[model samples]
Target: MEINELTEPERRVWEAFPRGAAVDLTGAPEREIRARVLRSLLLTAPTEDGEIAGLRLLGARVTGELDLQYGLIPCAVTLWDCDFERTPRLYGAEFRQLNLSKSRLPALWAATLRVDGVLRLTDCRIPGPVALAGARIAGALFMDRAVLGTESDGSQEWRDRAGRALQLDHATIGDDLWGPHLTVFGKARLDGATVTGVVQLDSARFHHPSDTALDAETLAVGTDLHAMRMRVEGRLNLRGATIPGQLNLAFARLANPGGVALRASGCTAGEFWMREAAPVEGALNLRRARFDLLHIAPEVWPGEVRTDGLTYTALAPVLPAADRLALPLRDPDGYVPYAYEQLTASYRRIGDDAAARTVQLAKQRRHRTTLPLYGRLWGHLQDVTVGYGFRPMRAAGWLLGLLLLGALVYGLHHPRPLKADEAPAFNALAYSLDLLLPIVDFGQERAYTPAGAYQWLSYLLIAAGWILATTFVAGVNRAVNRP
Candidate 1:
């Protein structure tokens, strides 16, 4: 395209491309620029001596599809506050940087696109899906305050793509994905995506009530995934994700009634901060998830939480045993022993032995419900005597009470000696001790025999002693053998 044949507005952009000068078309009558002319200039425009050439246009009405598929753009391309007549196609294209900030577009199809520098779509209004699947971005990708997707048009295609407002499936971002205050009318899918830096989606709003709002399953992030104060109308699925840094969801509002609100099963994070968040309207599934520190408020937990196989090294705010027990106690799938064990282990890791023992006692109490009638009876005996081995002092109390009772009964009525020559002193306390201790022989019980009703009292004392011994031994064995 010769300079003389170009339109006045086109000539200005063409001349400014070599020097990387901005051609602001705001409030100008002639704002229309052909996408083909811009593409041609980007591919063949000559740069000034020692000057980096870039096309920086502002407030232009770009007509026709900007099809740069498989093209290698030499210079950075920035078209801020521009209006696109159709969706730009950049599939398999390579660029140094690409910024379309504050632009109004029908959609953006940049699947398999490669960028050496940052890609900014900040504050853009895109009414259709933005596909970035398989994109490799060296620098951060910013979509802050960007609105993607519109209400359904009632078509089958629209319905099928309803949950996919922004698709970055399998994409690899070398730097952060900054999208604070973003609004996605559908799902923001990042399945199998990898980010080398933090992913900030703080204060973002995702609306896809019937399906997943943010599907980042199997995503691997190098740093924190900050979605603080974010609002999601559907499930926030992070299943199998590995975030080495914190996954902060403070003050987030997640809603998916009767379904999984936050499905993060098998996820691994350093710290999971969910304090001060709204009570989830549905089940919070963290099954098999592992975290170094889990910071959550006790009152903020939903009615249902699936914590089977979940393991956290520490818990924040240091809640009591009863407050922490609410997690496993409210598990929809009943009798998950692993959940209680993990909680007990967390308490133990924090050096809260009392809380750990409390959790262990609660676990035994919960397990009692799943036993047979005889097993439940046995469990009740163990609980009353020793608190299922968690409360060791209870066993001592039972022993003392039984010993005192036995001594009091036998003291008032001295038993007749079976053999006067072989009998030891008739000490009531010594006789009671000998009767209570099955293995210890003071010879007082063996030498003397009670008569009449006193004989029945002796039998009762022997039976109680045996029962107490059995319970004590069982509790001690359980506590000693437990890991």
Candidate 2:
């Protein structure tokens, strides 16, 4: 089709161009007409070897959208580059098939344009300040190594495209959105830049988190999402970047002392690089982060750990100094915990015998108040103390006399089994058992005087009688006359 066969408005737009080696459309207005011209080019784009068609759009806003998809007869023209050296324009405006990978775009013309089309920039490079700030579109906008913005005074912002929210609603692509090492001196807003594709940034270093995301609900500020530290360079500054989705920060270095290098507060993703990094002053909020516990640092516990690797689990107070007998442990069924059992366990682990004893008494006292078992148990103990404790302790004196009489009779008759110089077994248990049996069953013999035999018998009988009287019953007369 010859150029004149085009629509009148299309022809008027075509006439607006200087038909030279590279047609110049530098001074076109940002009106609907300019949009129409770009749309025409999109529908009937040039191909082939010759540049029929160089369009130097110094300044124009081509806002028309044409659904020019693939198979729309690729116009064979050697459209190598565009020269908007001083113009800010949207040249090859497309709404569908946009493969402008090798187009030489105008540099630093200071324009804010929107390409509401699928921008397939495979190796496309652009120079200057681009403002696609709040532009919303439903296509993939590719800028792989496609530089935006000058490293001048704006060396601290990502204005190469626009202010924020560079929306890419489900822009599916075969290759990664590779822009690893590009520095956006300002914020690069790709808030919901949803891509059903692998977006690879082998070593792309973001300057700061504050200016990097649009709504940036999924960028880690405490940590960088890097592929073995290659997708990043220099110090990363993500102060409050919120990652609402999965953020893989594996092997990324963090530099902030107390401030978190990446703040993935509510992120939902794979393994993160939170280990062996600098301390964080900000929160490493993985509150509801569905991260594998194994991926998290071994030091990272259930509660928040201080940036220094100290977890709350390690700070349990030294099991309270004493038992809480006065306290009650009521379950949903209103049954109190066994006080005695709790104390026993607590004291065993504490390894304090004194405290253990105290806990025991408190438990016993509490048990007596609440449970029925204590009455029988304590009463039994008290009775035993009176019968065995005092009796065994008191009769020790008279029993010694009776024991002496028996020892004398046995010793005199049997003599020493072997001489007093006999050897003893060295086993501690055996030795202890020997000494214990004697102490339990007998007492020491009295010092012998050998007064006459008659006298000896008489004294022995009296001692025996006394021992029996004490063991059978305390003398009524003696007790009544005592006080």
Candidate 3:
């Protein structure tokens, strides 16, 4: 169509735009679309081509219902110098990338935008606020110096990457945002964006060392918030961003939250500065990263982040509360689970089996209350090394007390002799009673009744107790006594 064939609003927009401002659209075209877009362009860019331009469409507007299925849209070839009074409902609009590098984008509102190519917004301006609450945009949405701020919309002010989301991982955002300097590089930056739409980042990278990445130090907003169950395919950087909402980095991973379940794995921001961040309802993640002094839970750095399987330096302090109780520790020389695991494993390999057993016992007793689940006979002795691990004198004292108590009880209540031996002192019948009495008492009681064969039974019980106690002592020596 000729330039004169354009609608009133279309004509105005083309005039306001630089000399080459063009809108090659198809299907039923509407004038309202042209007028709104033109106004927005003027606000962000007082002049698109370093010259005056106007908006007046003589033709119809390119309007159509959203179609996520085929991603059909009559407004395919979008032009410059346009102001979106409303988001111009394009429900499930899908298309190749829209290059608005030299144009203007004011109040660029949309619920979802799926572009197969790059949604480049190089150097542009926005009049009012740009709301993409539940907008799902495929490909990268590049916004280099393309302001995402709110104009004089009253006292209620807002930010840039608020709303449902805008998947621009690895995309560049070159401004400090309207209010908060957030990196518009995720599926959502709505930490406190007012809109209650659920933001998702199944696996999005957050870095643009090229275009918009260098202008600002702070990048991405989800650094202090959880992607819920979204997949994070890239690094989440929140070097300096105000998080008005709680940060939830748990259960999400840069690799996968399912296979291994990373509490806070994907994020590797050395010093996660969430001082301006809000308290999370559940937990924050810092899993699978090498942090010098992390602030998240100890789980973030379970034990120590070993690099290349080398002896790694402990970054964070072992949570006393976490390590206070002994756990069923795994082997020491094998793979280490956490820092505490090493303690237990050391006991297991403490040179001698007897000593190892003693250490294991100590660990179990010490962490009994604190580590109920990990309280294993063997494991406990390994990690904790309880009660100084059985001193001979201490053992003697306890044994003496037990013997005295037993003697007193025996002298007081001796069972009537089942039979008396005629032989001097050597009661053959009493010898028979010796074994039978234990069977009768223990067998009939249906409980763990101690044997009545005082001399013999006592000797056996003492032997068993000593063995267990000895194992603990050995384990303690191996664990603490070692460097």
Best by lDDT: 1
**In model 2, which runs have C-alpha deviations exceeding 4 angstroms?**
1-40, 43-81, 86-94, 102-118, 122-141, 152-176, 180-183, 209-215, 218-247, 254-260, 273-284, 293-483
Name the top TM-score candidate.
1
Model 2 residue 78 CA deviation in Å: 9.7
**Model 3 lDDT per residue over 232-312, tens place:** 322233323333344434443333222211233332333332221222222223223333233333333222233222111
Models 1 onward score TM values of 0.93, 0.39, 0.35
**Tens-digit per-residue lDDT, 92-113, candidate 1:** 9999999999999998999999
Clashing pairs in 1: 163-187
The C-alpha lDDT values of all candidates are: 0.89, 0.37, 0.36
Q: Write the per-residue lDDT of candidate 2 for residues 36-91, one digit (tens) a residue.
A: 44545645555444444333332223333322222232322222233322333332
Residue-level lDDT for 238 in candidate 1: 97
Native-referenced Cα lDDT, model 3: 0.36
Report the poorest 10 consecutive residues by lDDT, candidate 3: 208-217
Better of 2 and 3 by TM-score: 2
